[model samples]
Structure formats: C-alpha cells, structure tokens
Target: MTPETSAKLAETVDNCRRHAGDWELGITLMLRTHVTIDLTGGLPSVDADLAELHEIADRVGDRWTRAQVASAAGEVALSRGRYDWARAEYEECLRLAREVGAHTEVPFAIARIAESAFCSGDFDGAEQLLAEVAREVEPYGGVYDVRAYGGMLAALLALVRGDLERARAECELARAASEMIAAPPQLTAGLDNIDAVLTARAHGPEVGLAKLGPTLAAAVAAHCAERVLASLCDTAAVLLAAAGRSAEAVRVLAAATAWRAGHPRSVPEQAAVGGLPDGTRAVLGPDRYEQEAAAGAELSPAEVVTLLTGS
Candidate 1:
C-alpha cells in the first residue's frame, strides 16, 4: 500500500470507530469501509475488530442492527476463508433477524451463508440457499440493492459450477444492478470484469488473457493486497503459460503458494487458484494441502443448510 492510501484507510478506520455508537450510521460506515478493503483485497488483522463492532451493535440493543452486525462479521470471516466461522456468524444473524422481525436482513444473511457454502464447494447448498433468499426478498419488492449482491453471488456460484454462459448472463445482470445502485465502482467493476475474463478464458487459451491486463494492473496500483495477489496469480499464470514461460508461471505460483501458506487463516483455497494456468496446481504438499483442501472440500451440504438456518 502507498503511504497516501495507507494514511487514508487509517483515517477512515479511525473515523468509523469514533462514530461507532450510532448503529445505523456505524453499520453504513463499516460496510463502506469493508467494501473498500474487500475491493483492494485487504483483510482485517483480527476477528476482534468485527467483535468490537458487534459489541457496539449489541449495546444499541436493536434487533436489526444486531443482525446487520452478524451479517457483516460473516462477510469478514468469509473473506478470510473461515467458512465454518462465516457460516456460524451468518446463521446467528439470520436467527436474530427472524426473531426480531427484521425481514430485510433475512435475505441478506441467507445470501451471505450461500456464499460461504459456495466457497466451501457445497454447490447444491449454495443454490438451495440462494433460491430461498431470492424467494423471500422478491416479495418485498424487487429492489436493485438487495438483488444486486445476491446476483453477484449467483454469478460466482454459476462460474464455480462450470456454467460459463449462465455465469456470464448473471454477471451482466449483477453489473447492471451494481451500476444502477452506484455500488462501489472499483470493487464491483473489477469483479464483473474478472467474470468476463474468466468466461473468455473458458473459450480458449490462445484467445489470451490480455483483456484482464489493464484491470489487474489497476487493481495492483490500488494496493489492494488481496486483489493484487489474486489478479497477479491469475493473470500471470495465464499470460506466462501463453507466452511459453511455464517456468516463470511455476515461480509465480510458488510465491503465491508460499504467501497463502504464511497467511493460512486469511487466504481462501479457491483464491489461490483463481487465475492460474490449467494443470498448474500448487505443490504445497500433503500436510498443508490436505488441511486447507479438507477445509474447502469436506464441508457438508447439511452443515451449510444448518448454518444458514442458524438452528
């Protein structure tokens, strides 16, 4: 991160913390900050940051606010690749939202729980949860704000399921909704563009990864460590392989593998392979590999359903 950007993010964090007592305003500020950090691919240093924010929400003693806090914490945990933890948070958020009659939060929490399931490779669970969320939220008026985020999740789920055409269509819908709502342009745009690039890659290798270059460059310049790392790993892998520089690709993958190993708790398994060359799996070996792989692979659909229900 640049000095200027670092200073700005620090200022934002401080300002949000200073106004933490007002649940509505605080949640909005925190959500904005979270989006910014997420786009830049940064993760919070500790769970306690989320816990502190939740503590403030609890003090407010409003059901809606508490649900929002839980949802936000679930987002943070999901971003960190703590799928089970994310599931737990969102489950609790859902229960509280339902109990308090905060219907809006119900769909939002459901969307988040679905994302956790998708990340953990429970595709059926993700689809089931999204279907339920869509149904619940659609009746409340088909507003772009609620549906936009859910659409993005749906697009991602489609991508993971190997339905490139469906994913592209859903991504276009998400992009349109995001644009309409004036969602954080940087984050949403990058994600939409990434989906496009991935779709193109699915067509052929020689079609090249050039289309992603500028966006990836912009992400790196933005100093969003998480975004930069993901973009670099993906873009470099494809470009290097296309250029016949498999050795460099391997080296880049190695560095990425090492980085993920270093931040085991923070980096997601799918993230490590996001934009890399086909057949270029990270040789992080049996022990560490099995640990993270099981974390992603062995997650049961039932567990996801239970987590979504928060029962």
Candidate 2:
C-alpha cells in the first residue's frame, strides 16, 4: 500500500474506533473490525473490541450478531498467532451460530477451525473440518470466503501430499472464488499468499523470490500475521534455498520462527513442507545453520521487513 493509502486507512480506523461503543453503530463496528481491530489494531484495541462487542451482543440477546462478533474475536486471536485461543473463540461462534440458525456463519467457523487444524499438522482433521464447511456451504451456492477457504484448504492439503495437479486445480478455484467476492482486503491477501507459494512450488523458487518484496509489503500492510509469517515468509525461505541462497533461507526461517514466538506463542508447530526444511538445514551445515538462525531470531519486525525488502 502507498503511504497515502495507509494514512487514510489509519484515519478511517480512528474514526471508527470513536464510535465503537455506540449501540447504533454496533453491527458496523462488528463487521469492520476484521481489518481495523484484528489486523491493524494493537492488542489493547482488539481486546477492547472483543470485550465490548461480546458483552453487548449477549446483553441484547442477538445471537446472530453475537456469533459474528465471536468469529471476529477468533480472527483477532488468529492474527496474533494464538491458534488455541482462536479455536476456542470459533467454537463459541459455532455454538452461538447454531443457536441462531446462522447457516453461513456455521460453515465459516468450521473453515476457521480447519485453519488451526492445518497449522497443527493434523491434515486428516483439517480435511474433516473443511468437509463440514463444504457440506454446509454446498446448499447455499458459494458464500464468498466460506467457499474460497474450502478450495484453499484443499489446495494446501494437495500440495503437502505431492499432488501438484490437484493443488494447482484447487488453488485456481480458490483464486477465482476470492476474486469473485467482495471480501476484506486481508482475506484476499491470505489467498494471494497461498497463490504466491503455489507459484514457487510449480515453476521454481527463483521466480517467486524475484517478485516477493512487493508481495511481502502488501501482505504486511493488510496486517494478517499468518499471511506474513506462515505464508509469505515461510515460502520465501523455501524459495531462497532453491535459488542457492541457503544462508538467506536460514535467516528467513529464523525470522519466521521469532515472529511466531513473539506474537503468537500459542501457535501450533510449523508443519514440514516436504523435504524443504531438512534439505535447507543440510545445505547450510548444522553448526552454520544454527548460527545464522540464532542471528535471525534476534531481528525485530523492522529488521525482518528490511531483510524481506532487501533494504
């Protein structure tokens, strides 16, 4: 994003925050919180929104709105890399959605759970959760993110299992689905990250790395931590390795790990991507790799951005 665009967004979010407690703007706040609160806001801001919305929704006895707020809270947790907390929030969202007969939200929550499951390396479990999303959304004839997330989960699962043909097919479907909908910029960023990594997997890592600086900037601007760390940074590391930049790959990996530890200490393990991890480590030599990784772990977000941007 341009600095001017980012400044405008910041101003807009500030205006939105001023009305956060207004009952008349409750639903708007609930909907807009995805980017402003979860993605862009600091922890105090997210927690405040979560507390107020969750409380007011319960007090007003509006289960549907409550479900939506619950889902957003889950997203806030997810952005912070608190996967377990996010799962719990999604479970509450599922429960409230079921109570209110919120058909669309029910599947949306399931897709979210699938995300956590994928992060945890439980591919079978993630598949099961996404199957529920698919079954539920099937009757609704494609409900935006719910439909697209199903395709994305399938794509990654196929990629992990070495089904390149299936991965490509599913990823294309996801990219199309995401583009068709008026989803949040952050949501689209997530899909785009998936697309970027898939490209690396397909042609060669050099191609992806060559274009990644702008991609990383865009994803970071969206404030989707998983997109930044898990998708972009992680894929860039793999690409660096493939391009004979093994030390650079090690540095990126360290940054990825550190970012997770600092922001989302509760996130599940970064599941192995085929032999990429082992191969990269072997190329660096174990001792040298550790030294580079330790150096990387010490870099802050600014430093990580510098490294990513090649500045």
Top model by lDDT, which number? 2
User: Could you give candidate 1's per-residue lDDT for residues 1-311 as a string of tens digits?
Assistant: 45676577567667766765466455654665465445443565434556666677867887777777777777776656778898998998999989988777788888888878877878789899989988988778755766777887787677656677887787777777777776654446446455645645675533444444444445444444553344345444555555555544555445444434343422224453554434433444345544543443333322322221233
Question: Which candidate leads the pack in TM-score?
Answer: 2
Clashes of each: 3, 0
- Name the lDDT value of residue 220 in candidate 2: 67
Q: 36-59, model 2: which lDDT tens digit per residue?
A: 553433444556656777777877
List runs of model 1 lying over 4 Å from the truth.
1-36, 39-42, 45-48, 185-190, 193-199, 206-208, 222-232, 235-239, 258-311
The stretch of ten residues in a row with the least summed lDDT in candidate 1 is: 300-309
Question: Which parts of model 2 have CA positions greater than 4 angstroms off?
Answer: 1-32, 37-44, 221-230, 261-269, 273-291, 294-311
**Per-prediction TM-score, please?**
0.69, 0.77
